[model samples]
Target: MLKVNTENSVRYKGKPKKTSVNAGRLKLIERNKEKPDVARIEKPTTILRGMRLIDPNEVNKNMICSNCRKQLAFNHIVEEKTTGFHHIWTMKCDTCFTLTKCHSSKSHFNDGHLYYDANTAAVLGAVHSGAGCNALRKIAMRIDMPVLSQETYKRYEREIGSLIEEAAKDSCQGAAAEEQNLVVEHIDTLRDKL
Candidate 1:
């Protein structure tokens, strides 16, 4: 599970305000291998690290360049997250200025990977310069996709790629079938942000 914001540099926001279930419920779910009713903090969980987590296995076809207002290059996927110190967050485009809010599951991958705040990164910096400084930079140096560990990366693609393409195809068909013009306020507002 993941969440992101398009407006401000706030890391993953929109985590639920609080969980309806208590810790006991969580433990029960864990024991049953069922999903937990994860809740967000009073505010959104601060993103301590940035992840490019991408669907590198499948080609991306529903690419939209916020700056261009045109379809982006096929197979183009960009993911930027907050990392390093001071909540360093990034997106694919440098021109994004709009804001958005969304809520998602809190499932971090099973991997030990986790987001870290500047303080956390600093502590880590003492151990690894390149490791603590900039995850975006680090990931780029390692592979073409931001989330590059061949096996994990493929899983990432499998999870997100199909969802994106299916959405695009459904949107297109829906637009053709309906004469009503849906006011996509966010898209219009975020169009200039690339």
Candidate 2:
């Protein structure tokens, strides 16, 4: 017969023995415990309507040189061109001498060239609201904002006017079809009753 100690049995379970904590790790834990828990929140990008005037300093602060990986200051930027509210900036990286072109607004390829979405929207809104170019110019002047030229507005109007007309026709046709279907349904109900 094998003699076994019941107190030191293989199946005996007890509280785990505490291991010696490293002084450096213990100090780090204590330091972390003293500090307040901070929740980091990220800024959200939202699709904005109307217009917003952004400071040049803000734009400069956000701009980084692609080649040198350095922030491009306002002095390093050269104003290349301005198309309505859209502005083209040519940045010369001082360290690498690399020329980088940046646009204030995104451009869509329309026709043979590029067109700013803001300019198109402005024209469309003006036409739809019956405000016209004059009213838009007046509003822009009052706000000290860049006004779209009458000629450019006219060009966009010409391009978008046809599309608006086509959309209106489509809407009318759909409405007529729906009306006819309702009439047919009503006639079928009367015939069923008779």
lDDT of 1 by residue, 64-96 (tens): 344544434312223323222221122233246
lDDT of 2 by residue, 83-173 (tens): 6665556777889988777555455464668554667777888999999999988987787667789998898889898889999999999
Question: Residue 194 CA error for candidate 1 (Å)?
Answer: 41
Q: Which stretches of candidate 1 lie over 4 Å from their true place?
A: 1-105, 109-139, 142-147, 179-194
Clashing pairs in 1: 7-99, 16-40, 48-116, 49-115, 49-116, 55-157, 93-194
- Point to the candidate with the largest TM-score: 2
TM-score of each: 0.22, 0.58
* lDDT of the structure predicted as candidate 2: 0.69
